[model samples]
Target: MTTKNVNLVSHPLVQHKLSLMREKDRSIKGFRELLNEIGMLLCYEVTRDLPLEMVDIETPLQPMKAPQIAGKKLTFAPILRAGVGFLDGMLALVPSARVAHIGLYRDPETLQAVEYYFKAPHDLSDRTVVMMDPMLATGNSACAAASLLKARGARDIRFVCLLAAPEGIAHFQKEHSDVPIWTAAVDERLNDHGYILPGLGDAGDRMFGTK
Candidate 1:
């Protein structure tokens, strides 16, 4: 489903893997592998509209014009720990894409995002940037990460997550309406502690076997 700035992937493969991830008894290795597979699928969805240009090429039989992605190589910016889970799969699809790391953690009491580290290519303004995370619950961390990217001159930015809550999507649109969001599913709502209910739990914990 496509909304104003949110795109729900909803592919059968994505939905099936997501349901497996949501199971409380799923093994850490299984969860990690599934997340990686979904990341690759999401990467395919988000880059579907990237511009393409025809180039001269020679097939074994004859010469021909072939299509290749146009413009500068894109960048994948993952939001710290959980976001890293999506990195390998995305990189596997776009091996030449650049990578930027944005480290932000949510404050438990206030449910706000706090940044601790950031690093990116200096030519961010020249390339498309995709910010990634496993979950978008409160939306604070995603917004903060986008703001940081903007400050660094990232003009074309996109956000991708595994799951999202309605409140989180609303909050994100209110803050960064221009940045599009892509996810597998938008669940019911946030709980008292600012977590997506029926979410796959803390993604970082499940992926890393942490408490």
Candidate 2:
């Protein structure tokens, strides 16, 4: 079942940590840490409704039944550099999850996505895919990346990001309404160059100290 498409994770801890991440002068190390920490928290919300199955297990003494996540394998596909920042934190929550990488960058004037790299494990139909990226500004790259995955046979896919813009969300839903969006905040709007205003700047630069 397709859960509600867009999710705004407004938990207090998420909000406070996101605030820390938005500071322009914040150190790269500090921003990276907060990104991962918040990624874990968002992971909690994204996986909340995953199916569970009961199984018999032996405890310290007798055998008893316990619930475990249904055998729905998970794949975390991060969109290149910035998205990688959220992976470690998410792995802490689901170490067994496979990782996929999709490399796409926006064209300067046209703002369209150009793919550079794509990789995934086999049996895409059996696994749930979570696309990770720190910022969803114009939604070009995210939508393009999700389309690539769908072309490869992935049926269950969702998106997770730290920040989003309304224009981005609308464009994303228009293209891929079946995929849900989980984000920490939806800022005011995207600036002329397609950057989210009041956003934490270029996520790749902030995460990697490139700018």
Using TM-score as the measure, the top candidate is 1
Off by over 4 Å in 2: 1-4
TM-score of candidate 1 to 2 decimals: 0.98
Please write out the lDDT profile of model 1 over residues 1-211, one tens digit for every residue. Answer: 2268999898999999999999999999999999999999999999999999999999999999999999999999999989999999999999999999999999999999999999999999999999999999999999999999999999999999999999889989998999999999999999999989988799999999996
* lDDT of all predictions: 0.95, 0.92
lDDT (C-alpha) at residue 95 in model 2: 98
Candidate 1 residue runs with Cα over 4 Å from true position: none
Model 2 TM-score, all chains together: 0.97
Output the number of the lDDT-best candidate. 1
